[model samples]
Target: MHTRRPFRTLALALGTAGLLISGCSSGSSSSGAASPAQAASVSPSPVPAALKSYYAQHLSWRDCGVSGFQCTTMKAPLDYAKPDGGEIKLAVSRKKATGPGKRIGSLLVNPGGPGGSAIGYLQGYAAIGYPAQVRARYDMVAIDPRGVARSEPVECLTGPQMDVYTQVDQTPDDDAEVTKLSGAFKKFATGCEKRSGEVLPHVSTEETARDMDMLRALLGDEHLNYVGASYGTFLGATYAELFPGRTGRLVLDGAMDPSLSSIELNRDQTAGFETAFQSFAQDCVRKSDCPLGTTSADEAATRLKKLFTELDAKPIPTGESRDLGESLATTGVIAAMYDESAWPQLREALTAADAGDGSGLLALADSYYEREPSGEYANLMYANAAVNCLDLPPAFATPQDVTKALPSFEKASPVFGEGFAWAALNCAYWPVPATGTAHRIEAEGAAPIVVVGTTRDPATPYHWAESLADQLSSGTLLTYEGDGHTAYGRGSDCIDTAINTYLLEGTPPPADKKCS
Candidate 1:
């Protein structure tokens, strides 16, 4: 596929430290026939050659039992093409089946990020939040994917380097600022190659999907039963594409569209953020503490946009040298879009920003960037970039591509499109070239796959969930008309009950199931 160079773009996404970061990245694809499915009753396939040597070198298992749980490590080839080239160890943990009757097998979990550590999710959330019956009948498992935490990580920049990078003016105007921004991008990319060249090139979602297959075999399961969130949905969809028959009771919440090119993905996401912003705006107008307009949602948006423009020209000073500029302000706003829970906090931040006290907004931005009070960064951004760069090729090749794409992006998301479109360019200058393309994933004959979407989800839009559901031959759309990134575990009892029933009983939710 033809790639275009991207121009400057703004950014935002929370990583492992449980905060958001504003930036962009790039990715690759895989070519291999999935193993044919056998009867639901059968012995596990032999470990793939790629996993055997990997298992020997990197894994060291120990006793880990949290009530009815057993933890272990699973190893696989870093590069599927050359499985033996080297191995990357995945941190695997599982809460074994506590059955009332016949038990199925292990059900793996991934909490998105493309970089969000599944093990972290398993320990922090899923191990407790998942429905009791589902937890009772099946082994709830988690694996940190290659280049993600607990695996061979991909380190890009240090805490201090990231501090500078995050503070860099994202919205470039004059040539000098653009040069500075581009230099930051170059430094971040080069740092990835320099610090993690060995595995950076192999961290694509497709590779991670393949790794899932190997784990399925090693766990002695006949098929893979898994639940994925946010970017995890993309990973699950990719797995379904590659190993259709092996899929079992899969739940892809906060679904991502595999067909959209980088430009389309960024544009759609930009619009999604605007939709979320509109929701927040409408809510804010009704609330007294709203920093923006107290009238219509559009008025609130207009007020916010004007602030963004003003900040672009003259950044407000925080107590620290780093102030709330257009980039950081945008980052704070986008971070709020991820979860409605953050809306009030964002309003406070905006109030602070409006009053020329940018500390609140900076804190929000810092949370998004996952920068702790101590200034250390979790590996989330590094792994996010590594996986993104490997999943698909660059979105832009030159500044002209971004320019050409700007109008369409703006139309898609009047608030966030241009910045996101320009942000897509960050991959253009990646040290490792992208090897993947936007492709359709039609998991024909796969067991019914439950796809969950939140109506006002920020990171992964609801429509993408609808599109992915339509694309997968057996995908069943389960809608949660609510706010948040992923719906299953975010306090939606109905959503959780529906998914839990499916996971435990193997009965898919109704095709058009809607839970408010």
Candidate 2:
């Protein structure tokens, strides 16, 4: 779910919730404590005088066009190590409790993007879609992390350039095709360096965790109460690791394990998508209108791969200028796997694409890119790559690396393996080295942290939640025995009640609780 392209859009479905719903500290200061190198570390020292100015600076809130939502901006150090070096502005938004009870405090919500706009999520979903009791007692809040939307966003390719990049053949048959794919990756990285090099180095989840603490202090919350989905779960975990004592009522839905290397993460995610796709195929075959043959899931998968091959050989024409090539078609299929609700759309898109009309699949791919009808795009994909590339080393350092690893990737996912392996190459061309490495996050001394996982979550795998929960000292695992990218506010009343109880009553559900 946390991949660079279509995976980044996992938060989109969760973000449309008004209708639906919505690290480490510095190191070396404590003996026997997990070092920064071992986890998403946070600074242990008290706020420095220079940084105190930023932490204490007052925000000027104003109407952000969303009724009942007040927005403001906060300043954070571009480099946390150098508090006085330079500053970055983070966009913050809040909707006060509509209460029939005493206000508890601010409940900060982030829809995982690493690149997703928390402020946009706050105003659009969390403000109105959360449970009434929880909303009545908590100030719903969100902050667009630095380099995300409304913040000083990271920008890379223009719409046209992105279209070309997205359409590039991913499953290359030979060295020339591989080179072309590599060139596309290089182009994307080069664009980021040219447009957002300065902010690129500082957009790691570790930096964003520190920013969250500052927002926490500014909002006067003694403890940080939060709900983070997908990549946001990683952010929440990082914050807990950094400020364990400050963690309160945290719910990490669609959790990610920070301990996996880039290759491992990519492999696991590829397998996850395969798992989700299998589930989709099983359901699809049962439906009469399944485009990928109406036999077994395995047969459907074969048909799907055949479609990719066919598109690779001969791109389907969309009414729009963009045609449905292998890459775009794959992305469209991947997009639908994020949520089951989109399955119908995927089926329709596939049916149309098979009929030589590619508009449906192209539209789905565009939605995955957060592309506007006018061909403009949001900063989602740009920021996704920026943060992902900076946070960890590239999954593959070269095309040869991808070539060598192709078999294992293919074993993990026969349908998506080649493309994902190639897509993982994007970070290889990054202008900067990774700022943080993968490590276990125990978040020692933290309060009970609820980690929620959907069994069939395509983006963030269920086992990841288990791994993360096991790593956190106070982590509790809550399983939703169902499908989707996230569990909370997604129509599982059981999941919702458990999360709401923890948020409002400061009591986590049973450590091994499972909700169907």
Candidate 3:
């Protein structure tokens, strides 16, 4: 279980993780070392005999305050190696099938924040918005991973503390600014250690993957049928690697390669965001109201870069205690890169920011942070760092390392690269050492899994999907020749039809299948 982890103070931008290329590219990442012993294998160690009770545990479900949904709590060992030492409870939710057709069991959904609340995703969007045919045939299910919302969430900074963290200058110009940013990182890590002391080490993606398996067995499913997006893809793939024989109908949209080192992950994601911005810029320039200007994409990029520089010099007002600084502004832009649907709002936000009213961009930044009107934030960022820091070693152990990587990062995206390089340093100050390493995951004997990729996906690059498909022995590549993060359920009938067919009928699309 591995993926990208950006600056928490900036809402985990630049997509997630460094990934394995073809043939489990033998590469070492900031994630410790690429040891074969740590690498995921087709033959995973069997369930420990001591953990029989966990496998046999029962779920007591009842109305969870939400209409048409049932909620339950699940118990699993906090540390797998010490099953009896302690246990953690995971939050689970499900909406039973509408049932106009034959039931096809539970369809687990995870919208990949790594720290994202799968339960929230299920209730908020997936339960109501999925295709009627699919919803009617399957019970929509989700389990908020440990240390995520509704679970034993990981807490770091308070709302006010986080507010200050968010405005930290990502593109530092002077030694003082760099030291200030480093101090902020240290504060955040120290806070999490003080606040979420117990669960930090156990929140790795691998742990969440095991949690998913526990859910699968508790639900009485012989095989896991899951739709995982972004970092969720890494979780799903890890499950397949750990329990290949029990995996079924896995759809990994916006997939993450399990083999990425921290440096590769951050660099690749920076480039990925650049690709997404290029698409947005091209589209924005076609309209007269383009915020960056109705000019060539290159010129638009130059203008956006200039704006970032200007914001770094002096943040504009957002009519709030916190101003729209470069960090927040960049986060706002990166948030829109995840979905084309948000592009219009991004354009409008940029238009407003350019005119000295930073409110719109600030609002966009708030959305990225999942900030509520009351100023409280969701646990997404805290868990993101908790899991990511545990999943891979820091990309750079010192600020000097980041300075060394700056040239390469800048080459990736001149507009966003410098900030991203600095942002990558966030994990360096993690309270605990990384428990995981950059390794390959090949679910050798698993059922054919559908891997979906959006060509211009800003966060999880299309190449990642390609590499993931190639990594899994029984993988099928389903390409959506379009933009955005994930392809399915994004208005592409061709992509959705293929996924729906696989979920409903268990027949994956043909090799080299392409959708627009």
- State which candidate has the highest TM-score: 2
TM-score of candidate 3 against the unseen true structure: 0.92
- Residue-level error in angstroms, candidate 1, position 452: 1.1
TM-scores for candidates 1 onward, in order: 0.88, 0.93, 0.92
lDDT of 3 by residue, 125-199 (tens): 788878999999888889889998878999999999999999998888889999999999999999999999999
Error of 1 at 221 (Å): 1.5
After superposition, the stretches of candidate 2 with alpha carbons farther than 4 Å from their true spots are 1-45
At residue 27, what lDDT does model 1 achieve?
Answer: 14
- lDDT per residue for candidate 1 within 379-495, as digits (tens), equals 777887777777777677766687788888788777777677767777878887787889888877677899999898777889999999999888899999987677876778889
lDDT of each: 0.74, 0.82, 0.82
Lowest summed lDDT across 10 adjacent residues in model 3 is found at 29-38
Error of 2 at 105 (Å): 0.5
Clashes of each: 29, 14, 8
Best candidate, lDDT: 2
Candidate 2 structure quality by residue, lDDT tens digits, 398-446: 8899999999999999999988888888899999999889999999878
